[model samples]
Target: MRLLVTGGCGFIGTNFIYLMQERHPDWKIVNLDKLTYAGNRKNLLAIENNADANYSFIHGDICDKTLVTNIIEEYQIEAVVNFAAESHVDRSINDPAPFLTTNIQGAQNLMECARQAGLEKFVHVSTDEVYGTLAKNEPAFTEDNPLIPNSPYSASKAGADLMARAYFETYNFPISITRCSNNYGPYQFPEKLIPLMYTKAVAGEQLPIYGDGSNIRDWIYVDDHCTGVELTLLKGQPGRAYNFGGAAEKTNLELVRELLSILGKDESSITFVKDRPGHDQRYAMDFTVAQNELGFSPSVTFAEGIRKTIQWYQDNELWLEEVKSGSYRDFMAEWYGER
Candidate 1:
């Protein structure tokens, strides 16, 4: 099978590519990434000289219809897994225009291009945040959860999810979507909560804790998310959306404590901060659909995943350093400027 993975150079996307390369030797993988601030080609260095005979990379944007269509035809891609988007909630609050452009517009562009290209399967990766925070004593988010996105980022993703389902129902496009929980693992940009707190705590600097740190989220390992996505793309029913969960729910304070402990830092390392506007109080996922339908279950528990992730940061210290130095930003500016 030949697959085109948008944002494949980014965190979870890169891990997905690596996982596929390891498990399926005969499949060809094409990584299409815009190389934005969060996207880094360095994340893919492990695949530079691999045993897999079919792997390639393309630097492009999902919004470019002609480019997307051309690549689909040239590569004879049988499947497309879209992971591209403006994902930061705070950043989306700062500037929602970009989120609208990428998350909603870009999704529409890709959907139309895939339709024109005769695509076989298209899996749209999404987040459970689209369901907003569960009310007090409410049930966890299920596949039938109504989208009540709280922030611009989640709203835009919800818009994209709607479009994905629309295309499938209206045009009979072979599309599936998986709304997953918070993912934490290596290659994640330091801006997110996990990497951000880990970096500051390790540097002996104050770790910023938003609000009282009582917000809850279902944290899933990035590798497990990749596997679940793969299963959904292969065995999932078309036009259906799956919920992928780690069954690991933790409050933000608990998460910070875990990070501090893993980094061998003291309690003094933490600093409480102002709350985010429109912050969701909690998020949980009921992943029964994915488990029963795709046989997808997380292999790594939350505690185990955290240990592995912390070790990765320790071993890849130089990577963390370079990322902090801002060359990645410069590279994105330079590369995207020419395009």
Candidate 2:
């Protein structure tokens, strides 16, 4: 397969590219990334350095319709896997303009280009947060759940998802959406929970927890999410949406405490802070449809996934340091300073 994977320098996209290369050696992949604060080119250094590798990287934004269309034409791209978006909930709260531009408009551009090109498949990677919060005793969110996105980030994603459905309905576009739960693994930007807490715990800095840390999220290893995406790309029906999850639900407090324990640090490092506005109380995914149709199931348990994640950060201290650029530090300080 010849694939154009947008946002390929970011967390999940990087992992997905590596997984595809390893599994499908003959496949050619073109990575289009904007290299935002969270998108780190260092994540794919190995792939970029290999002269014989069938991989290519284009530093660009998905909102650029001309660029997207040209890349599709130039590469003779057969399919597209869009991971591009403003994904962080806090960042989206801070500024929603980027999320709107990238998540909604950018996705529409890709779908339009793919439709015009007569592409075989397109997979838009989304998050479980679009289903909104669940009560403590409520069941997990299935694909049929209405999109009740609360955060600007999730709303933008939902907008893009609806657009995808529209294209399939109106233009007969071959687009499929996959919504996954929280992902933790290597190459993840440090702004996320696991990496943020891991970095702070290792440095002996205060680990900040939002609003008593009772909010819950389902956790999935990056590889498992990547596999689910690949399956959707290969087999999913048009206009259909699929959900994938790790089946591991942990509260914010429980996750932090577990991380501290893994690092041999004490709970004294944890500091409760004011929670962000419109904070969803819980998010869990019911991926039964994906399991039954795509033969998808999470392979990594949270225990094993967390340990592996921390080990990767430990081994790649240089990467951790390099990715913590000036902008990242400023954002972290400013965002947490108010909390």
Candidate 3:
């Protein structure tokens, strides 16, 4: 397959690209990433170093219609999997403009380009936050759940999902949307929960918990989410949305305590902080449609996944430091200029 993967430098996108390369070595991949603050090109250094790797990277934005259209024509891309978005809820709240531009407008651009190119498949990767917060006892969100996005980030994603559905209904475009739970694994940006706590704990910095840390989230390993996406790209029915979950639910406090235990840190290291605005109380996913139709199931349990995640961070301290220190931006500028 000739595939175009957008935002391929970001966390889940990076993991997804590696998975595809391992599973389908013969496939040609063109990765388009804007190299935003969170999109570190260093994440795919191994692929960049491989002389025989069938991968190409384009430093650009998904919002550039001319660039996107030309890339589709130039590469003869058969399919597209869009992983690009302003994903952080706090960041989105701080400024909603980027979220709207990238998550909604950028997605529409990709879908329009792919639609015109007669692309065989298009998968818009999304999040469970689009369904809004769940009560402690509410049933997990199914794909059929109404979208009631609570934050700018989730609202933008919901807009994109709706646009994708519109494209399918209006033009019969072959597009599938996959919404997954919180993902933790290697190459995840340190700003996220697992990596953030791990880095802070390692540095002996106080670990901050929001609102007594009672907010709950279902966690999934990154690779498992990638597999679910692959299945959706290959077999999902057009205009349909699918949910993927790890079936592992953990409260913020529980997760932090577990991390502290794994790191041999004391609970006294935690400091309660004011929760951010529009913080979701809980998020859970019911992926029965994905399981029944696509034969998808999460392979890694949180206990195993979290351990593997911590070990990966421990082994890649240099990478973590570079990210934390903002050195990668300098390297990226140099790399881009040289290209």
Candidate 4:
């Protein structure tokens, strides 16, 4: 059961690796990551020296079509689980070029490689941002929701989602796309809202709340999201999209205030900031298909997840500090503790 798992060093990817290792120790998993700003080898250190012979990590870019094909052929990879992407909305707003090249071209590279390889499952991990914002009282985004991505980050993902459909319709290649809500968990880069607030709150800094902090979103725990992805690959119908959501709705300000309460902090830490241009007002998901079809639903409550996440950040202050301070810039040399 050898599989290709891209972006395995990123936050959700890291947690998914740990889950897979626990569930299927006999399965050989190939982890490919580019070690981008958000990718950190330290996140995978716990699995590095394991004697289970179930894992290996490769430093490579997903946009390299030749390299991607070579690895798939060399490994005889049976399935492709794509978690690679330029995911930060803020970063996308700042520089859309990298997001476009990596998200769109990189996905094309993988799809062609998988189509040629005849992989059984080509699962593309995506986000609900593709559906854009919803009007008040509008039905939550289901699998049937139209693609209306606003930001460069979401536009790139939406582009890949369509291409995946093209491959499935044109050549009948097995493909599955999973659009899940915002994810929060351990090892998340502090650039994200939850982790950023956690880091700042701990350091006596003000937390930036954007646009009156009224933007609403459904938050899912990273582990629960992994479960949905795993189930979708094995039990889901091919050529279909699934929406995995926590169904726990909260405004940005509400979420931040909850975090402050959980951390025993006060609201004084929050400071209103200039809102991001074209920021989606709200996002919600209806996971009916994921629930009834794949029997998948979010297992962790948002509150429980947020509390655990806050604790994780507190415990892993050293790693968070390195990432925030750019100390991970020396990863190439000190990757495996080679000082």
Per-candidate TM equals: 0.95, 0.99, 0.96, 0.95
By lDDT, is 2 or 4 better? 2
Candidate 1 lDDT over 26-129, as tens digits, reads 88998889987888888887685665558888998899999999999999998999999888887788679989998999989988999988888999999999
Q: Clash number for model 4? A: 0
What ranking of all candidate models by lDDT puts the best one first? 2, 3, 4, 1
Candidate 4 residues 1-339, lDDT tens each? 888999999999999999999998877899999999989988988898886658889999999988899999988899889998888887787679999888988998999989888888889999999998997689999888899999999999999999989988998889999999999999998778898788788889878888799999989999999999899888877789999999898999999999988889999988887888898988999999999999997999997899899888888889887887774334422421231
Report lDDT (CA) for all predictions.
0.88, 0.93, 0.93, 0.88
Q: Name model 2 segments beyond 4 Å from true.
A: none
* Model 1: how far residue 80 lies from native, Å: 0.1
The candidate scoring highest on lDDT is: 2
Better of 1 and 3 by TM-score: 3
The residue pairs in collision within model 2 are none
Superior by lDDT: candidate 2 or candidate 3: 2
Report how far off residue 52 is in candidate 4 (Å): 1.5
lDDT of model 1 at position 159? 97
TM-score, model 4 to reference: 0.95
Candidate 3 accuracy as TM-score: 0.96
Residue 71 shift from truth in candidate 4, angstroms: 1.1
- Of the two candidates 2 and 3, the one with more favorable TM-score, higher being better, is 2
For residues 1-339, what per-residue lDDT tens digits would candidate 3 score against the true structure? 999999999999999999999999999999999998889998998998898999999999999999999999999999999999888886787679999999999999999999988997999999999999999999999988999999999999999999999999999999999999999999998878899899889989878778889999999999999999999988999999999999999999999999999998889888887787889999999999999999999999999999999999999999898887784445434432333
